[model samples]
Target: MSTTTIRVRAPSEVDDARTGPATGRLRRRIADNLTAYGFLCAALVCFALFSWYPIIRGILLSFQQVNFVTAPEWVGWQNFATLFADPLFGVAWRNTLLFTGLALVVGFAIPFAVAIVLNELRHAKAYFRMVVYLPVMLPPVVVAILWKWFYDPGPGLFNSMLRAVGLPDLAWLDSTDTSMLSLVLVATWAAMGSATLIYLAALATIPGELYEAAELDGANLWQRLRHVTIPQTRFVLLVMLLMQIVATMQVFTEPYVMTGGGPEDSTVTVLLLLYRYAFTYNDFGTASAMSLLLFVFLGGFSALYLKLTKSGG
Candidate 1:
């Protein structure tokens, strides 16, 4: 059969035809990238100025003495040495650790348990959620002040209830023994809502079929929770646990407003101690050193937590 001869275009010609669109695409991509970077520059600059600069400056200040008046004088480890020598340093660490442990035991689990219960409810969920989160909506200062009134020895709600129940009126914040617990109570009331909501969200994501299968295997409520619920939500629980530790360790406002770290300095936390170093003692260098120490401790704790969780998972 006779066929018409077709002329093939030269490779160079074909490349030339393709080059224009390729160059256009490259230019367009460069332009898009430049536009994206231009948009990101403002956020980058703000983060650098506000966040990164403060962290670097704080570290530098830890090694230097400054009074917001004269030039900062570099003093090596003098600030850290002074902090270590301070009598309140050990007390602060002890109180902070105690608070963190108590908060973990009380504040951390309560939210998860509440979330589990709330998840099972078929009605009044909205009302219960609103009630649970109501305290969180109030200002922290207001909550502290409110709890201060609640913990008052005279005509306070707690004492009134105790008296009504024929129990002796107990000194809540006034006692060194109960001051930290009182603070933990208020913190739990104010903070547990967020964690509860987070847990509720995590619980919702769990497939119902898993529970059905678990039940089919003759698992009871506690068994199912231990085997399925906990393991499924283990990551979230661990994250919340670490977060509670960090927050409790840095406690300040409750003790500052309620007890002023009083009742024999029983409620003094690491952050409250840091505040004293900076303001009460007028020693910025030592405060910076303490802050750096706290940062390092929390960072190490977080790293350790991640490692443990990863290994467990």
Candidate 2:
């Protein structure tokens, strides 16, 4: 009976009450977004300054001629034309392709094989892993110097071993036939450790039941590898293959330090040629042009890789 005197609130008041919490939540979300962006600003600034700016500047420089003393002058496609006309351009590309190919065949395959073997081993896994990765920890300069000594024609470890084993002594780095191979061998040795560890990690992630299932189906070692192991790690293999190609394309230090692009320029790589263009030739525009060309090539390859991976996935 007392409810007869009850007062009803306005519809607008009720609506306001319902929306109050949602308004607070929206404000809080806006504040959170602002905070996140504030935190990201520093990294964004650094990337713009150091990475993106240089890339843009390099692109601009490719079409301009500039030395430190004078203002940059636009030269259209002159730099690119000069680059193409350079005799070393073809040689550099050829050597780079050869290095990439050999590295894929030897460096790429060896690491995966090593990883497979290592994954199967239950004994001294840590020791073996350490041994395999030790070279990667060594400084690149140190590795280069050590391998230089190893490849020495006289009193070198490799030739000494050959002598001890009564095998013919081969010029590891001196011969035009073997200089590039020697570089590949050293690069593989120093670099394979990382790939091996990566493959090992990838292999570990694969389900044990896959291997068991294959075995139950009477799959032998080779069959299991073909059907299960490789397929399971195919994504990693493709990524590593692309990475190796990119890396070998830019090879410079090994050829510079080991052979100085010697044995009739057998080891001259794209990066080494770029270095000579910039430093030895003092042609910054041409160097920038070469850099742009290399960037475009690698970028195209990366796009293709992404397309393939997306479709495969």
Candidate 3:
């Protein structure tokens, strides 16, 4: 009787042991999936509200005239036609392209060089990185205002430094010749911080053995950097290039705050002109049209860049 009772209890105990952990694991997996889905749903909702909604609204507005005073009137392609007819439209595009080119030449290379230097340093890296990134921490408006003061013809820091060294002060923003380049400098200074940190992270990921192998093969610093470092980080470089181009093309803040598209509209940009249409001119349709064009352009450019990079890779 004792043996039979023990056998019956053993079977039930084994079943409980088998099911207990499996049930717990199933519950945990369900909980994890629920949490992941909750976060994803929230993200989708926010993008729908903020990003997608505005894009759809802008697309609609591009087809209709809205001044907030009258009922919106559908105008078909009138807005785009008007944009093309405007003289400043051409100037805005030209200046925007010029600025983008200058920024790519200046802004894209400096951060990489700075990152390499920082990575090679033996001491006080954190301090230098913070210093380099400090400009980016400040507000864009504040940065523009600060640089505006620095570029002031009468009492600017740059002029002061020039005078201290007995050199003549150039018309940094007042002259059309120097205005765009000056703005590029301001932008490059303000944006290089994050790029530098990203590059530092990329640099840190490179395996030590490859670099050691390069050294053993009698490769110098530049050789190793070209052959080892750059090849290893080609994907990163391509992505950063695309990002920089996109960002430079859409630049607005520094020019807005500093130049106000002045010095004979030498600093006018596409976005700045778009702002004028929306608020200054009260032609939301034209503004929307310009934004749509810009959006399509950036989208195409991004696609092309990614394709080319992928193929090259």
Model 1 TM-score, 2 decimals: 0.92
Worst 10 residues of 3 by lDDT: 1-10
Error of 1 at 286 (Å): 0.8
Question: TM-score, each model?
Answer: 0.92, 0.92, 0.89
Write out the backbone clash pairs for model 3.
none
Which residue pairs collide, candidate 1? none
For candidate 2, the per-residue lDDT at 128 reads 98
lDDT scores of the candidates, listed in order: 0.92, 0.92, 0.94
Rank order by lDDT, top first? 3, 2, 1
Please provide, for model 3 over 77-110, each residue's C-alpha lDDT reduced to its tens digit, 9 standing for 90 to 100. Answer: 9999999999999999999999999998999999
Task: List ranges where model 2 is wrong by over 4 Å.
Answer: 1-19
Candidate 1: C-alpha lDDT: 0.92
**Which of candidates 2 and 3 reaches a greater lDDT?**
3
Model 2 lDDT tens row, 165-256: 99999898889999999999999999989999999999999999999999999999999999999999999988988899888888888999
Q: Look at candidate 3 and tell me the lDDT of residue 256.
A: 93
Error of 2 at 236 (Å): 1.2
lDDT of 1 by residue, 248-303 (tens): 88889999999998899898889999998899888898999999999999999999
Best of the two (1, 3) by lDDT: 3
A best-first ranking of the candidates according to their TM-score comes to 1, 2, 3
